[model samples]
Target chain A: MLSFVGLGISGFESIPIEGLETISTADIVYLEQFTSPISESDLKKIQDSIKGEFKLAKRWLVEDGNEILEMSKEKNVVLLAYGDPYIATTHIELRARAIENKIKTHSIHASSSLTSMIGECGLHFYKIGRIATIMSEMKSLTTPYYVIYKNLIEGNHTVLLLEYNQDKKFFLDPKDALKGLLETEQGQTRNVITESNYVIIASRIGFKDQAIVCGKISSLKETDFGKPPHTIIIPGRLHFTESDALKLFGKCIDEPFDNSEKTEKISNQMMKKYVPMVREALEEIEPLYKNQKEFEIILDNAERYIKDAEIFLGEGRDENAILSIGYADGLVDALRLAKGLEFKM
Target chain B: MLSFVGLGISGFESIPIEGLETISTADIVYLEQFTSPISESDLKKIQDSIKGEFKLAKRWLVEDGNEILEMSKEKNVVLLAYGDPYIATTHIELRARAIENKIKTHSIHASSSLTSMIGECGLHFYKIGRIATIMSEMKSLTTPYYVIYKNLIEGNHTVLLLEYNQDKKFFLDPKDALKGLLETEQGQTRNVITESNYVIIASRIGFKDQAIVCGKISSLKETDFGKPPHTIIIPGRLHFTESDALKLFGKCIDEPFDNSEKTEKISNQMMKKYVPMVREALEEIEPLYKNQKEFEIILDNAERYIKDAEIFLGEGRDENAILSIGYADGLVDALRLAKGLEFKM
Candidate 1:
């Protein structure tokens, strides 16, 4: 049997009670630290507590799991990892392969930084949307940029996990990650990330030296967030209780504010521009062809559609609002083009 | 001083190593099981392990927090709860209050069922979107229904936490939750939930008899989920590995398929109907306005807008697509109305 166990977030001390016994009793235990680096003291403590043969597993060894599977066939083997073991797709795949090979597999789930950091930062976990990862080698940060945009418009917090390459002993710095996001805002221009946007940097969560610092991006520009394994949380809407909790729990360089307030949804952005523009265009063309029966009918439809558009927008039918405004704009523009007037669309 | 420790998903065996020491050495240990119920065996084990004064804390005690906060001012009080402590908003609020009172606070993060259940079901944790809770007393399930709809369109998994009323010993059954979603579909008509929709009911996770049963809602209608603390998972897109892992790790009543495939995005749904309808409308009125010079400009613009709408939709500019199509329809309709024909919108 092959057992997968999590070391949880706080290194040796956060491992589940059952996981301790599983590692001690196993014939062989392979500790994988590629997901997150472990401290020397915690590593020593984990080694001293285990009675089994201990081997450090690299990322490739866990991914290419022939030796682990072969050993588990005859002896009890345990593969331990940082955070919840199955959060890594490679671990889940390994478990599936073990089951297919007729080897019994067991999992011991432990605390993950993904879930832990939110609470440590005093943020509600339920409000977290789809998580995004920022790799240092990526050509562009558009994917994660839009992720934050979508989450913001929906009033959901976004958790950004930075790249950690264990082989290179490299961790993506939080400052660089923030800079990348700010740069992405230049191209996307969705008002998602700005200098004044509030962000929380959760550094070394679940550790004794864990620190959570929050402020606008500009204020945090000169701030130094010590240590590796940092996460950035861009909160959307904030309940009063949440803001209070954040103020009491973390180091605040500035008062907490909602980032979602600045980032408007695309449909709303369209409506904001077109609603007034379409109405003005209709007013401009109204007297030009007033007494003509067919043109008057077109003008009447344009005015009605403009009114309908505003109602749809207020009712949260954003797509319909945009569509209605566009139609009205089209009607007025068509008439202007036929009469050789200035184009409004 | 006060400490908040999570008992993790498993009962006594799953507490963090640090958490166990904190509870054992604390002056008072208040075990709150309102979030989830602990088994009798686990309860007995927990009581035996605590060397300090052990007290059972009800929901009110935790929510009120005055007693605990007062005790923490002078005594070492620990509030140990099932799953991760901060997952409950009440705990976060209490922590905030403790901080406001100048009481030192500590947290020992443990495994959350929120993250664990996703892995246990062989689903990717990052794919999880915003979570929704379904209460038995809710007047309508429309809120959760739309949440599922939004998550599905984004190809993200939805985790539906069932209502657990600890005082009444009442837990919303997984079957009832599923039925409620189906009923919600009748009014919402978003194709988010139906008899044919696939779902997974994770029952008593982290326990000995934990079962992850998944299939179509119709197939699971007669399934006896055995116990309370059940959670329903509505998976969006299924990666091949995810499907294979689910079939191997859980009881599969039917073949795993993408729930997202059946549920189209509202924008896409709009485009599907409007694009073709506008094209048909344009075709019918094209020849009638062919010779008329002023009306021909309108007809030409209509044709261009229709084509632009299709291109925009294909490019994933959904709002733009809808706008373009609506504009085309209005142009065609305006010309038809002038000629005493019918309306297409």
Candidate 2:
């Protein structure tokens, strides 16, 4: 039998009764070290609770082929993954390998940073898009940037997790992450992210001293959010309620520019130019489309228009491009009409 | 000051250490009953942990305007919610309300069903779509069909949470739910679901002795899954890895259907009749269209032809219809390329 157990987000106390039982009953216990690390104190607590010797598995043990599969045979083995068992692609592969060997597999789940802890910062879980992990030396990689760009195009909020070394003594802070993202955006000529935009900086989530600070990217450079295991969030479109939550719980008062004024100006400009185009697009397409066909067309056209508009904005033709896309959306009845389509953007 | 603390999934043990501290220190604690009900034993355990008194808040206190909000002004209030604090839309509103009144607000999040817990039954979380709650009296409502239909079309899994009523000792069981869903699908003229299809029935998830069974809906109808808090899952598209997992962990084992045999038969029957009329339509539109445009026209015509070809399959067409739809997903790439569009299915 192969069991995958989540040790909860913060510490040992967060694990549910079922998860504890699974860990205790296993013949051999292994912990995946990459996703989220359990502190020595927490590890000791789990050992005491389970009354078993816990072994740490490197990323290669789980990610490499056949090792875990071989271990699953002839033993009641358990793999302890931080957060939920299958949140990462690595664990998924592990489970797949175990199943192929006809091993009795179980996933004892607990709180994950993806959902439970992210909500503590007052962000809606449903509104979040694909999560991005920032590497310590991100210049060598395009994977993280690709995830962020795709998530932005989908108009879903992106959660940026900072990469930490094995010791947990060092981590990529939010300011450094913003700089890296800004540099990447500039390199790619993606204008979606800017210094004036508000980003949420959260530190020590699932802990008593957890801190959440919301401010412009420029202002965040000088502020210390405190501690490791921090994350940054780049928001896409904000709802009225989300905006209100930001104003209240986030450090919106310390913004570099008048956010309300900028928001109003942006809204006014969008309404003036884009709304009419969107209306025209809807009128032109509505007569010819129905059911799934209509939904597919609208989704396809909307994605194209949004992409074009982003390019136009990046090239400094903001007004014409914004209006043109707005008109296109209007023609498609884009004012939340595409909600049923579940298109990311 | 106002605090929203998530009580984690599966009773008292699932809560993080920070959440417990917040509840222990709060002058007034208000737990929302509607989202998730804590067992009496769990409540007693919590009371024993905390030095202060805990108050149970009815649904009215949460939904009613300004009641909880007003109380937060006079007291250091902590509002307890199930799973994560921001999973529900109401909690978002409450946080915003607290912020508006200048009351300092914080959240201590814990476990939520949104995690990879569903994988306990060997199902992937990413494969699941927008979750839909199944009410006890779904016979009178059209929602179940709509939600299931959407999930099926998108090739995503659906998690059907059985409704819990406070006044009555009634909870919807997986057996009744399967029957209800089968009836609803039949009534709507959708034939994707059948007695032979595999369904996962999970009960008392996150608790000790949590039961998970996977089998044909007909096979499961006779077995008692045991206890309250049961959920039913209908899987859409299965990856090779997922298929293996299901085969290993899932109770039902049957010979896998041959896709090639079904597809070839369906294609041959449809091609004999529908291809000629589609070709005729393509010929008429060829003169006015560009090369790329003409390709799109032909593809659209082909899709329309396939839809019409469904009439040939008749009642025996149910299984074939599902298989065909799954195969047409390959043509979806061609359709997108020809139409020069980008969209999620």
Candidate 3:
């Protein structure tokens, strides 16, 4: 039989009661630290409490799964991991493989920092959107940048997890992660990440020295976040209650503000530029073709479509709004093309 | 001091080891079952194990918080809750209040069914989008219906939590929730939900008799998903490994398939209908202005813009695609309107 147990977020004591008993009785217990590394003192305590043969499983060992699967066929084996065991898809796949091989598999789910940290920061969990991880080797942070943009527009908080490498003892600093996002904004220019944006750095959650610091990105630029295993939260819309809780629960360098308000949707961005540009182009062409009866109808239709576009945008029909404005611009520009005026579209 | 301890997803065995110690030594332990119910056997085991004074904490008592918060000032108080204590926003709020009242507060995170059921169903946790709840008294399921639509379009899985009223001894049936979504599709008509869509029903996860059943809505119409605590999962895209795991881990009456493929994005949906319609409209206008020199430019530009729309759409610029097509349609229809023929916008 194979058992997957989680040593919750806060070191050794956070392991579920049943998880403790499972690891104690197992013939072999493999502790995997690739997800999140445990402290040396906590490691010693875990080892001292275990009755079985304890082995530190590397990332490849768990992923390869040959020895663990083979041992579980005869001996009672437990693969103990940090956070909820299955948060790592590898463990989920391993469990599937065990079931496929006719092995009885058991799971003892424990606290995960993913679910724990939100409450720790006093943010409502239901408002969280799809989480994105920032890797140091990525070409651009565009994917996660857009993820935050999308979540922010929808009034959903984005939880940005920094990359952690246990083998090299490497953890991406929250500052570098934010810096990458700011650089992305330079290229993408979606106005998603700015220096004045509100962010929260939740450091060492569920640990004895846990700290949450909330402020604008500028305020945190020089602040020292003590340790590794930190997460950055970009809040979208804040309820008064949430703001109150955040103020009471964490250290505040600045007042909490909504990041969603600063970031405009792609449709809104286009409308802002094109609406006035189209109107200006139409004004220039109207005088040039005033006496031409055939051109007069097209000019009138163009103005109507532009107005309709704004109304559609206000109604939340974004695609239609963009389409209307684009059509109106095309109409005006077609005349500009015929009259040898500069094409505005 | 007040400690919010979680009982996790399973019965009594799922509480964290430290949580167990805290409850045993506490002067008062208030077990709150409002989030989810505890079985009689588990309840008896918990009562027998605790040396402290045990009291049942109802939802009102916890939300009101006067009694528990007042007691914690003078005694060692632990508020025991089902699954992760903080999954219930009320518990999070309670903890916030405890901190505000100058009482020390601690939390023992446990297995949340939110995370547990996804793993149990062999779905990747990172692929999940923002979660939504379905209350029986909700005027309509539009909120959850749209939540599924957004997740499906992005190829993210959605976990739908049903309403559980402990006071009334009631839990919303999975079928009823599915039915609500189906009804929503009829009114909205974005093709987000249908009878042929694949879904998974996860019932009593982490319990001894945990069951995960997957099939199309049509196939599951008469299927029995036993027990009070149940959840419905609407999967968007299926990676081969996820599909393999699902097949091996759960009982499936029908082959699992991606619901996202059938539901086109709103832009794609419009393009499908408009591309052919615009082309047909352009064809009709060609015969009327074949030799007219000035009118010929408008016709040529309209045809070029129509083709450009398709190219832009194929390149995944959805908004630009819709705008191009709408522009083309307006250009063509403007010519159609000037002529004695009918307008085809």
Candidate 4:
């Protein structure tokens, strides 16, 4: 039988009581630290508590998984990892492979930093959107940047996990990741991340030295996060309670504010620009078509649709709103084309 | 001082080692089952372990919070809740208030079903989007329905939490929630949910009798989920490994499949309909403007844009695609409106 156990996020004491017994009784325990490294003192305490043969399982050992599966066929084996074991897709895939090979498998879930950090930062877990990982080698941060945009438009918070490569003993700095996101804003021009945007950096969470620091990108550039395994959170709309808690939960260099106010949805941005332009074009061509009876209805319909677009936007029907405005724009521009006037679309 | 502790998901045995020690030594422990009820046997085990005064806190007690905060002014008080502590916003607010009142607050994080359920059902945790809850009193399920649509477009799984009213002893049945979504699909007409859509119902997760059942909604219509604290999962795209794990980890009435294939983004759906309609309209009107040199540029631009819309949709620029198509359709319909003929948009 194979058991996948999580050490939780707070080092040794965070493991579930039942998980402790399961690990001690297993014939072999493979501790995988590639996901997140542990401290030496915590490592000593973990080793001292185990009664079975303890082997340090590297990333490749867990990914390769053959030796572990073979051993589990005859002996009880536990593959222990930091945070919730299955949060790492490697562990989930291995569990599937074990079941495919007719080996009985068990899982002991624990606290994941993904969920833990949000509460620790005093943000509602339900308000968190799909998470993103910031790798050091990524050609662009557009994917993560757009994630923040979508989440912000819906008033959801975004959690971005920094790259932690155990083999290279490397942890991507939160500052550099923020820098990358700001650069992405330049090309993508979504205004998702700006110098004055509020961000929280959660470092060494669930540890004695756990710290949460919040500030704008420019201000946080000079600040040093104490250790590795850091996460950056870009908050959207903040309830007053959340704002109050954030001020107390972390060291905020600036007052807590929403990053979403300045970041408009692409649809909203286009409407803002096109609504006026279309209305102006319609106004210009309406006088020319006053005597033309057939075009009167088209102009009237265009004006009505533009009004409907604004109402739809006010109701948060963004797609329908865009469609209305686009139709109105098309209607007016076509009239301009037929009349031999300079066209605007 | 006040401490917020999590009972994890598996009753008393699943509590973190440190959490157990903290509760055992505290002056008073408030066990709140309003969020999720505890089994009688599990309740007995928990009461037996606590060395402190144990009080069963109603939802109002936790929400009111005045008595707890007053007692914690001098005593070591613990607020024990199901899963993680801060998942309930009331607890987070209470903790924040405790700090505001000059009382020190500590939190012992534990395994949350939010993270555990995904791994338990063999789904990737990172692929999960913002969670939504369904209540019987809600006028409609449109909020969660649209949330599912947005998540599906991004190919992210959605975790739908069912309403559990401890005061009323009511848990929204997974079947009913599915039915509500289907009813919503009729009026919304988004094609986001249908009887054939794949879903997973997770009941009593982290308990010995934990069950994960997945299939098409119609296939699982008669399924007995057996207990409360159930959660429904709507999976988007599934990797082959994820599908393999789903088969092994749970009972499937039908083979595991992707639910996202049928739910196209609204923009893509629009382009699919408008691209051809506009092209056909353009072709019919070509002869009308064949001798008109001034209007040729408008017709040509409209056709080129219609083609650009298709290419843009293929490139995954959904919003841009919708805008371009809308512009082309507008251009075509405007010409059609000027001519004495049937109009198409």
Candidate 5:
């Protein structure tokens, strides 16, 4: 039988009571720390608590699960990891393989920093959208940038996980990640990330020296957040209670504010620009076709569609709104072209 | 000083090692069961483990918080709750208030069912979008319906938390919530939910009797999911690995497939219909103005916009695609109307 146990986020002391017993009684235990590094002191304490043969598992050993599966066939084995074990896709795949091989498998879920940091920052967990990871080797940060944009438009907070390479003992600095996002903003121009945008840098969470430093991106450009294993959170709309909690929960260099305000949805952006433009174009052509009978119907249709576009937009039917405005603009511009005037579309 | 400790997803046996110590050494410990009900046997075990004064806290006591804060001012007080302590917004608010009252606060983060259940179901945690709660008293399920729609369009999973009332011992049945979504689909025709859509019902997770039953809505209609504290998961796009793990992890009445395939983005839906309609309209109007020099540019521009719309749609610029197609349709309709034909828009 194979048991997958989580060490939770706080090193040795945060493992669940059941997980402790599982590890102690197992014939062989493999502790994998590639996802997140463990402290040396915690490592010592964990070794002292286990009565079984403890072996440190590398990333490759867990990824290539032959040895673990073979050992679990005859003896009780526990594979422990940082955070919740199955958060890593590799672990889930291994579990599936174990089941396929007819080896009974058990899981002991523990604390994950993904969910903990949000509460530690006093942010509501339900408001968090899809999370994104920023790898240092990525050619561009556009994927994570657009993720933040989508989450912001929906008034949902975004949790950005920076790269952690345990083999290299490397961690992406929060400052560098922020800089990459700003650079992405220059190319994307969706107003997702800006200098004045509020962000929180939650470092070493679930540890005694955990620090949460937040402020405008500009203010944090020079600030150094100590230690590794940091996460960046770009919050969306904030309730008053959330704002109060945030102010008290972390070191905020600036007042807490909504990042979603500036990042408008694409539908809204198109409606804002096209609605008035189409209306003005319709008015311009309406006067030109005052006496023309055939053109009169086109102008009337254009006017009605302009009104319908606004109503559709108000009803949250954004695609319908854009379509209506575009059709109105087309109607007015066709009249302008037939009249030998400059087109407005 | 006051401490907020998480009991994790399991019963008393799942409490973190640090959490156990925190509760045993505190002068007073208040175990709040309003968030989730604890088994009587587990409650008895918890009482036996805590050497301090143990008190059962109701929802009102935790929300009011005044009495707890007063006690913490002079004594070592601990507030224990199921799952992660800070997952409940009320706990966060209380922690903030504690800080405001000049009291020191500490948090022992543990396993949150929110993150754990995703892994248990073999779904990627990063793909989870903003979660929503469905209550029996809600006038309409439209809010959560739209949330599922939005998450589906983004290819993200939606975690629907069923309402749990500790005082009334009431839990919203997963079938009722599914039925409400189906009813919502009748009024709002977004193809977000249908009888064919796949869903997973996770019940009593982290307990010995935990069950993960999943299939198409029709397949699950007559199925009985045994207990309360159930959560419904609507998966979006499915990676092959996720499908494999899900099938291995749960009881599937039907084959696992992508729920997102049927739920197309509104922009894509619009383009799918409008692009061809506009092209046919343009083709019909082309011969009418073949020789007219003044109308030549209108026909040419319409053809160009139609092609541009398709290009933009392929590039994932959905708003631009909708705008360009709408413009093309308007151009075609105007020409058709001027030529004594009925408008197609």
Candidate 6:
């Protein structure tokens, strides 16, 4: 009998109860190390938990001719893999060999990285297209960039998992990954990862220290995203609520402007053109109120319009903000029309 | 804060370690009854383990209104669900609402029916395709049959999960499911389910008293498969080694005819027509052996061929059996061809 067990994501605690049981009961256990590596502490814990001796095998043990076939002939063997057993193609080939040798085989499925932690970033599962892995030395590799570019063209959100080295403590952050993607796009004449292109960077998923930060690709270069096992998400289209959530929780237009002091000096010149329009509105509304009775209500109405306009402006929608500003201008026009009608004063 | 927890497939022991932690930390825990149900003992164990009150809600709590939303405002509410949190659409909708309302939501994913104890049955996970649940009243429902039909047409194996009623313990057995499928196919113009269709019926899966029986779906109707929580699998295609494994571990097939009881009646029967062919092969091969030394080798070869032919015949391969019989015939013809070239001793 051959047993395939998924070690789950995160650590040994993440493994399903049944998966743990299968590993403990197996006679000969072999772990596939290519898909995802378990932590050394977790690996030691699994060895202590299981009765059998666990052996780690490379991709060649299962793929090479007759190794798996000979072992599967008589003795009971168990193959340990990260995430779900059938998630990788190596396990699939091993299953086909076990079937060909007439050996009984079974698999204990567990939570895979593909499906488990994706919900943490608030991305819909069905909307995800092709998944790509970005390496640190990716300039020599063109395949990964092409996959992400093609998936984006199809209007499907692409999830790019950045590679990490635990021993070296060198992990590729989302900003670095976006930089690689930007370089690739520039070379290909595709200006997708621009300063305005929104990207979501999620760090330490499935852990307590998990963080989700959304911003433009250019702005992410200056952001400090802590920790490893980061994933970069490029959203295809934003729903209304998603856009609102991004504005509220994520970075909007409140980013620091470098030329704010210089812009303040020119504020008087800009204000001169709009002062007459502002003064005319203020003059028209002063007489219409006549008393402090309706003053609070009018002020509240104006406050709501200003708040709505600010939110619209923060989303990089100057035209939509103009519409709201026009609504506030109509209120002033109505006050002017009311004053011209000769109200009881 | 709102937490979504998966209860796993089995009783309380089946729940993941992380799920137990979420339940202990939650101020208010609510279980959705539609997706999965918990045993009374397990539910009581959970209630005793946690300090908070555990409440049960129907689909309406997740879908209809913001009852969960209203409770999660100030309380650290946790929603207990069956399987993984995102497997069902209701949980996904609930999570989306929690995110929209700015309520912090966490998901503790666990094992599901999709990862049930399939290892004991000796079936590979990659080989199994889209799963279909066989309801108790399958006679009135066409959904299960259609799913099975589609899976078969797509050349994928289907795992049929027999649904059981918690109140009445009314579960559909694998034999009954097979009969239901056969009847459904008969009702249609196509006769897909035959006496030779290989079906695997596993009863009491994940339990110690698990039983796996592989045979024709028609033959399984008569076999006694004890206990509940049965699963039926219909393999689309068979590889050579899979056929061998089935012959070795699965149910045995009865012979076509018996000649030991009445030799006189067998001699006069239509089955006697093949006796001459068997005799001619034995007579020619007997001449090749001058003593027991040569006769032993010929007898061993004949015995092995007969065993292989029997396995093929039992698997409903009369055509392949005829080919084996022809090979035995060729052995006799070779002896005849050799005898013609030799001088009589």
Number of the top-ranking candidate, with TM-score as the measure: 5
lDDT of 4 at B118: 96
Candidate 6 local lDDT, B130-202, one digit each (tens)? 4667786644436666555544543445677777664564667677677776677666533445555667776
What docking tier does model 6 reach?
incorrect
Q: What shift in Å separates residue B97 of candidate 6 from its native position after superposition?
A: 5.8
Better of 3 and 4 by DockQ: 4
lDDT by residue for model 3 (A215-260), tens = 9998899888988899999999988778888988899999998899
Over the stretch A1-345, how does candidate 5's per-residue lDDT look in tens digits?
Answer: 999999999999999999999999999999999999999999999999889899999999999999999999999999999999989999999999999999999999999999899999999999999999999999999999999999999899999999999999999999999999999999999999999999999999999899999999999988989888999999999998888999999999999999999999888988888888888877777877789898899999999998999999999898899899988989988998888988876
Best by DockQ: 5
**How big is the RMSD of model 4?**
1.3
TM-score on alpha carbons, each prediction? 0.98, 0.61, 0.95, 0.98, 0.99, 0.50
Error of 1 at B306 (Å): 1.9
lDDT of 2 by residue, B1-345 (tens): 888877777677766666777788888788876765678898888777676657888767777737677878887788888777788778878887777778788766667766644666556665555466778665443565555554555455667777876557578777877777777757655454568766777777776667767776777777888877778877766666666655555455353221112112223443443345434434444443346543443345335534643653454333233223322322333243334444222
iRMS of each prediction:
1.3, 14.7, 2.1, 1.4, 0.8, 36.1
**Per-prediction fnat values?**
0.72, 0.26, 0.60, 0.70, 0.87, 0.12
Indicate whether candidate 1 or candidate 5 has the larger TM-score.
5
Look at candidate 2 and tell me the lDDT of residue B338: 30
Ranking by TM-score: 5, 1, 4, 3, 2, 6
- Provide the interface RMSD of candidate 2 in angstroms, 1 decimal place: 14.7
Q: Docking quality tier of candidate 5?
A: high
Query: Which model, 2 or 4, shows the larger TM-score?
Result: 4
The runs of at least 3 residues in candidate 3 whose Cα sits more than 4 Å from the true structure, single-residue gaps closed, are A276-304, A335-343, B283-304
Residue lDDT tens for model 1, B1-345: 999999999999999999999998999999999999998998999888888898999999998999999999999999999998999999999999999999999999899999899999999988999999999999999889988988999999999999999999999999998889899999878899999999999999998899999999999988999988899999999999999999999999999999999899878888888888888988998888778788787888888998999899898788889889888888788777777787777
| Candidates' C-alpha lDDT | 0.92, 0.62, 0.89, 0.90, 0.93, 0.57
Score residue A198 of candidate 2 by CA lDDT.
Answer: 71
| Candidate 4 clashing pairs, residues 3+ apart or interchain | none
Better of 4 and 6 by lDDT: 4
**What's the CA RMSD of model 6 in angstroms?**
29.9
